[model samples]
Target: MKRNNTFFRSVWFIAISGLGGFFLSLTGLSIGWMIGTFLAAALLSFLKPSLLRHDASKKGVPKYWLFIGQCILGIELGQKINLSFLHIFKEYWMTIILMLLLSIFFSLLSGFLLWKYSKTDMLTSFFGTAPGGLSAMPGIAEEVGANTAVVSIIQTMRVFLVILTIPIFVSLWASNPVNHVTLPAQTVSPFEFEKLLWTLVLIGIAYGGYLLGKYLKFPAPWLIGSMVAVAVVQSFGSLFMGHDMVSWWPHVVITLSQIFIAASIGSRFHKSMFIGLKQTLIVAFLSTIGLIFSMIMCAIFVSKVTGIALITAVLAFAPGGIAEMTTTSVVLNADSTFVIAVQVLRIIIVCVILPPFFRLLNYWEHKKHLSSHASA
Candidate 1:
């Protein structure tokens, strides 16, 4: 009986989130579903005690919702993969490398400024500002005893800012762009047995890949694993089956996925998390803006040098989620595959390089504090 009640309350909360997403979708924003769901979930989460009648109502949306959303989104993106991505990467690998490195450097600079000026400790500030995926950073910070609350808030803020701003900017810029490559849309076929067989196969692969990724300890395993799994299948479908896999995706699936993911993120926010961090919040906001601006400047340079569209380059270089940015790229008719590649690479690089560096900084800071105490 208790479990049933909890399940029902969760359903009610998700219904509210869906309504929010639906209304926002009516406004025709490319990523309206996500932003609206996020805002709604956060508002409800912040007011849960006063508005909700049950303790279960105050609990966050389940993590499984996020996992499922990521899985669906990974499949969606994987369907977009094709042989041409190889050519794009081969042609501009150097430019891509430089842009990613510059973006990381800019984020590190912003992290440094936040550390110097804000009340947040160096580790929290750096991890918060690292442009690592929102899902990845808070967990990593917790392992190192950094302030996970602060990391979550700042990472959420950065993703929010990036999602809200980049789409509008890219849409406007795309209006007058010339000489940019727009990737081909996925081939859609009507529902049939062949499509059904392939869909089942892909779903199995997504789940299996996720488990494998978990075993291997990949970051955002559900997303990365499923994406890689399906992409490989789709990319080599012709070699094995002598034809492309038929995809019969509904547009609503993407919107629902966005809602699930966004709601989960928003539900993480609580009023208590911000109880005593006014100064830190303000500095985080400023540093995130600075970081965004720096990345935009870098994107502009890359656009000029690589001949990619300004909007495409910006999406590629933006410190945002792969799923969010790639969704925007698809909606705006930009090169989404490039955006995914870069976003994935950036996350891997940040996860690999920054954590150890931050650990070293933490150790050195600890040592310095101990020496000063001894002298005193």
Candidate 2:
């Protein structure tokens, strides 16, 4: 599909997306703003394809909206990073690595099952099942000769399931520990000039980080790059400058981020993407449930071995988007820093290692298919 280059044509769609987010926010769900926006955009695309140009010939809303949303989310998560994150990372680094490996193993296993049982091709199944960032997998899969439509649909479904189920599970079953990582208190108003100045600086830093991340070829560079840059400056500003950076940002900003992200994602969905994916969708759905369950059990083990809170372990290891899981952690009073750290590490590992591995698999699958046809 061609890019949706005209921003003016997208205004009405964006407005409806925001309205969807606003109404969903009323549900009091921690991630309702995102989910509501996603549903609205998706429904609009599916119901009235002409309005958004959600068809085979053209794309939906512009990509900049999602990038801006990710930048804001990265900054929000980066601010949650306190000096205590250093301690947590230092102490549980090995455990974190092991849990990530286990999670990836389960993800691949699920993908294998999907490929074997469903009618989807190997590349699509594998990329769809990978717990990499939702924004990264489809594009990467497309580059490697996978079905981008299938990968995108499946990846979105997986994230949607994880978002709806895992958070609720952790909140209900896992106990919140009293030893939460605490942030330093700030007594500044949101509209204070000093706070506003620092906020502007942070925004600039986010852009710089994004540029650096893009140069380094980081997956989801806007999100990860801005996150790391903001986190480092926010976490260590006191040691270098003899003063803590502003500790408080407005909640409305994060809400806006959620709306942008949700709208962008929802706009990507159309009936065309799901036309012949019935069997594949069913298989992917079941495998996703199994994958989520497997991760929960792994989280249980990680919690027992590392002495981390169960809820923290669950959120850290669960196969969900970084922003969604971190937001849930904050709402439930769990360890947000730890969750973000693990989530970031998971994305890094998956992006660095899995793409080439999946490409190898694709090659072998193609070879085998050619051989079978030759014999026939």
Candidate 3:
């Protein structure tokens, strides 16, 4: 009976939060459902903590919901992978590398600012300011021994600011008004026996990949693993079939996935996160603004050098997540293929490089401390 009551209350809270998101989406906000729902849930968790509190025996939402969300997101991204798009980079390889380097440089600068000004540890600052996807960063932070809560909060704030500001900036600066962004039409396979078989096969592959990633200890293992599994299958299948594979997940399913992810992240925040973190929060906000500015400048440089439109370049260079940035590009009729490619490339590079770099930093810091102690 107690479990039933808790379930009902959670459903009510999520429903109200979804409604809030719906209203916000009506206001022309990009990714409003995610932002609105998250804010609504976080506010509730802050103002009426008792309403969201869970005993040791009962949890607010099942962990499997989040895993399902990650799988949905992975499959969505996998469906977007077009092997032919690799040809687009042939002529612009140099510019792409330069943009990626600039992205790393700006992230490092932001991390330094956070470390010095916010007094966050070096590892947390680096991971928090990393330009990787929000889905990946917090998990990576935990792996690197960073302060997960602070990293998650700061990374979330950075993404929220980028999504809120970039569209408005583009609308104001562009020759035409940037209207509300919408996802491009996707080709979806019909509900047939073959499609059902493929869906089950894909789910099995995702699960297998998740287990393998867990064994290998990959950051955001479920996410990256499922993405790789689906993408490889889709890519090879398309090569053999001589056509692109259609998306199997419907729109409603994707929306539900987003809601699950957003609500889970939001509910993790509590009022205590703010008790003694004023300076850190303020520094995070300012560093995020700085990071945005730096990326904008890099976008302009890429635009001038490569002859791509400013909007496309901005979306490509934006530190926002792949899903959000790609959606923005589609809505604005920007070069979405290029945007996704660059964003994915950047994420791969960051995830591969940052962890080792962080370990080196840790090693050096330890050595320096020991040297000082010996001198003393």
- Please list the residue runs of candidate 3 whose C-alpha ends up more than 4 Å from where it truly belongs after superposition: 1-16, 47-62, 139-149, 168-193, 351-376
Per-residue lDDT for 1-376 in model 2, tens only? 2444456556678778879878876765456676677778778877766666535133677778778888897787676555556567787889988999999999999999999998888888999999985555654565466776688678778878988898778767856533443433323345677888888889999999999988987656777788779887887875466555774477777777877776666676655566668889999999999999999999998888878988889999999987678877876778988998888768756865887788788899889999999999
Predicted structure with the largest lDDT when compared to the true one: 2
Steric clash pairs (candidate 3): none
Candidate 2, TM-score vs. the true structure? 0.76
- Overall local distance difference test of candidate 3: 0.74
Pairs in steric clash, model 2: none
In candidate 2, residue 66 scores what lDDT?
A: 79
Worst 10-residue lDDT window, candidate 3: 55-64
Query: Which lDDT tens digits does candidate 1 get at residues 22-47?
Result: 89877655566776787787778777
| TM accuracy, model 1 | 0.74
TM-scores for all candidates: the values are 0.74, 0.76, 0.82
Candidate 1 collision pairs: none
Residue 242, model 2: Cα distance from true site in angstroms: 6.9
Which is the winner by TM-score between candidate 1 and candidate 2?
2
For each candidate, the alpha-carbon lDDT, in order, equals 0.76, 0.77, 0.74
| Model 3 error, position 22 (Å) | 3.2
